[model samples]
Target: MNSSAFRPRLLAAAVSLCFAAPAIHAEEADVAQAGQALASISVTGARFDAEPSLAPVGAIIISADEIRRAGANDVNAAIRKVGGVYGRQSLDGSPDFGLDLRGFGTNSSQNLVIVLDGVRLSENELSNAVLSTIPIDTVERIEITRGGASVLYGGGATGGVINIVTRRPQANSRSASMFVEGGQFNAGEVRLSGAQAWDNFAADATLGTQRTDNYRDNNEFKQTHFSGGAQWFASQFDRVGFRYEGARQEMQFAGALKEAQFTAYPRQTLTPNDYGSLDSDRLTVFGQRRLYGHDIAADLSYRKKTVESTYFYDGVPSPATYDSKQWQFSPRVRKLGAIKGMVNELVAGVDLTKWERTTASGFSAADAEQKSKALYLRDELRFDPAHEGRISAGVRREIFDKDYADPLTFAAYDAKQALNAWELQASYMPVANVTVFGKLGQSFRVATSEEDSYTPLFNKPLAAQQSHDAELGLSYASATQKITARLFRHNLTNEIFFDPTANFGWGANTNLDPSRRQGFELDAEHRINAAWAVNAHYQHVQAKFRDGVNDGKEMVLVPKNTLSARVAWTGASQTADVGVQWTDKQRYGADFANDCAGQMPSYTTLDARYARTFGQWEWAVSGQNLADKNYFSQAFGCKAGIYPSNGRQLKLSARYSF
Candidate 1:
């Protein structure tokens, strides 16, 4: 597979996904009008709006059109198209696809903050995001602010921020749409959505189901989701809103495997050791009012999630069964003031959460739970309409509840800890067409007792995790093209992991080392002509271990180079698109702290789609993996080989609206 023959085959396959548009040379008349204009105001803040370039930091604004073009129901696919974003699958399990920001993979939710509207979506325990359950249909747009935002967000702001804005109540519009398609390896999907508006109140709902043979033999999937919302204006001075969402998913789980089967038998048949059920529901209520020449706002949110899993071998359930639950609420208060020559908006908030987990094993019984709380604040000052800069800062203190241990399992242990984080962020627009931003931040995490002193076979306490992040970015745009690039670095303390060893053959969480990761990324959008459009992004990341950390190990399983591109053509009655993605070798082992493999091998994929509209009938056809390059994403495991990217799949779909 490493022969020179590989490059040509790869290039040939990738070229097939492209749908070259009929090119038309642009007239000089249009070139002059493409004035170096930059994009403006983004809804990633308190009022669901703000001028990001003017804010002085790095923010990735994803439009609704981008969402529709991705052609995938899962939100992960939406972000995956970006350079700095990646998703991971549970080893030997279904490629669950958890959101990763700036290379901070799974179970690192605290660093990668996720917010729905204004409510926190990351929970206690793992303090990670709930990416798999959020329905794409419920999202109007998403703004991803890269770099530390804890000065306003709290603990999870260590890595950065993701703000999801739900669809707003539409005006003078009524519509409903549905799509159904079937593809390679028994993959099929159906999606439906409807919306209506009357006066000042409106609402929308969406539902979808997708089943696939997955890239591996025993890997398969099924997901069901529902989302809806309502809003109202009580008076000229008062308003209120409510939203709800629920989802259920079941899938197989495979732990990472031995190298013998990992490389030598990358495609050999494999089996799953467990099955899991993930159920989640969320609700939100918010209110805003204008009084005494100032506007005030607040919100209350509630979330409940449970992960139930049963492990088995040869049809017999094992002791690895796990059950967990979470309860959380975050509230905020803000005041907007307009004075003589200045406008000031101040915001403050608090987050409350409690979580519990229990595992019953054929070998051992283990149980643990924690309750966490955080309070924070931020403010913005507006000086001039075209030349305004702002500063923000905040700190959060998290205290955990007393540990509760499973009485029957002598091998189980419990522990509690705390962390205090602080940060400062600023943004500025030196010119109307350009923006610059920077941030210096410090954030830390209390390690789980498991990371310190725990071997599945032996209970031991491990150390904690602490780190700091710094970022700087610049953005430029014109009518024809827009570009954004950012550079960032993170230094760590007590880098934790489950180390790999002989008796400790399995990775057990441990934190006795230090490390750092530095990276840069560029995202560009260009309109080549009336019929041609291009979306391109690239990233480079490097991780190095400090002396004696993880035994001075190089960060593995994290790709150092990633790239993505999509070119599209739209005409009078036809639309076409081509996309490609590539990733550098990904390091993986039986566990996080042990046996680091050199790489997963660099791989690429090409895909294309075409659609046409004639009268009341509409149809589309899509081709995936045109080169059939056998590849793998962090999404694959043993049974889910990171390399099973479907052997060239094509799906054709047609629909009619009466």
Candidate 2:
């Protein structure tokens, strides 16, 4: 896995590919034709391959080339390129990667909707889809709609949405690549992918594996996966595709950090038996097809997941081990320009899943299962001749098991709730240089299974959460820099947040009313020279629960301000990039005064990276946390906490093209 070995292998592959076919060079004018081939890739919400000068809300795109430069080993690290994104391995030494869309909260369990190639990874447990359930190796690109997309995507889209787009075979080339990565935190990984194209047939496959020693003692995680797809262009008017993805992930929990661990000045560590571990396996199969017209297409996906988790506290079993399984699927169809002045596209889908738990101590023999389903359709209106204006609206219905109650209190009361959502968006372009836009949408989030059937010691059932998103932005394109600015806000109701200290109970889902999160973002990308580019982004957030159970309390785990800047140099022989990020920290808990803990301190960090390519080989050398700063990303239950982050670590990696 050394750079030298990678270099030779890559050279050999390039030689083979070149000699395998008759060498022919195209003309200079053909460069555009060659580049256009890459543009054939299209996504659900992408207006076109052209990057929008102004985002509908706030967003960032990290191309595969960008990931390679940063030496990203997996999608978890590759996703950090976005301005507001942050990732961490939670206390259990497990993969708890999360995104703070529109500044809802830190962890995935808090809020946010995640999707993979149009399939709902957590379709069944919408509100509880943790990061470990996903296999990052297959992600080609991630499309993030930064604000709540509940209008079209109902449920759990409280903070917004993440659409994971996997790579596919192109009609023009067959390429293979393999790489290995190693770093601090006892991390190691290997990934390989191959794709081929011949006439009307194409295929692709990806294989990967990873392991990490507990950054905390005894809390380790290991994962393996395999995925592949094949497609046939039955004719110029029709096409169909089939794919399969399977994986398993395991982690030994290290429990929440103790106050002593964080207070330790120089170094902190975990003790044995902080918690036990669990392992899980998941498999999925999907099929899709497209009609001749550039206007119609459809796809369907199904997945099954089985998991086992254990718990240990005080060096003894805590009776928390459990196992479960589920089956889920989503089918969708889309049509473009179905009308003249009134353009329309409709997407209707349903979700079905069942779960059963093994009877265990401290937990309950509460063997129960649940099912949920939904169907939605949205139509878009675009008035092109009368200037530029577009409108979109949609709605959906949901049903969940209500009888799955706690066995101790066999007060079986199962009922299903149905909700409706809608959205409206408008964009105007008076001239070429400017485009003004505005949006308003209503979305609701369903409760997790745990939340649905629970008594917080002495409290009652927690209510479902809901919110609305409103936004406005302007885009100005210039010869050098492309400037885009946006101002948005989210109003929430029945927000469910963990309350460590509450009346009549150890913990309860406090209903916060009339709360809101507001923020502003400005992004600019400028080409300084033919070989140099500069990008800068600024974000500011002000969030708090305005009323109800948690009133007047500064929001927990929310960063008030952030600033990021990067300058990249591209040359025929090498590329270099350097970036810096500054963050203003806030608090770690909802009501700190009630829990005797104060607000968190703020910190800043800097990073630098460089990469070079020669022939069929590539190499990268980078330094993260260059300043070696120590700070916290998240915490829990007062003084005990583990910052889902590492300290001033260095990374080096190489890739071979074979």
- Candidate closest to the true structure, highest lDDT: 1
In candidate 1, position 474 carries an lDDT of 81
Q: Write the per-residue lDDT of candidate 2 for residues 1-658, one digit (tens) a residue.
A: 3222222222222111110011123343443433333233344463212113112333555566665555555555555554435443344454545556656653344466766665555443322344443444455667666666765555777676776666655576788887766777677778788888888898888787878774455667787777777887654325667777676666554443444566563134444443333344445555445543232334454444444444444456543444455666555554433242343334445555555443344745555456666666655545563444556666666665544545765634465767667677777767776767777877777665454444353324456677788889887776887787889898888776554454333444455566788899788888898899888777788787788665766676677887777778888878887877776876664343434456566777777778777776777777777887766665643444434355576666666786
Each model's RMSD to truth, in Å? 9.9, 10.6
TM-score of 2: 0.84
What lDDT does model 1 reach? 0.59
Please report how far candidate 2 places residue 233 from its true position, in Å: 3.3
Candidate number of the best TM-score: 2
Which parts of model 2 have CA positions greater than 4 angstroms off?
A: 1-41, 46-59, 106-110, 123-138, 234-238, 258-260, 265-267, 275-300, 338-362, 385-387, 405-413, 457-460, 478-480, 503-505, 590-597, 642-644
Q: Score residue 225 of candidate 1 by CA lDDT.
A: 76
Looking at model 1, report the run of 10 residues with the lowest lDDT sum: 13-22
TM-score of 1: 0.83
| RMSD of model 2 against the true structure | 10.6
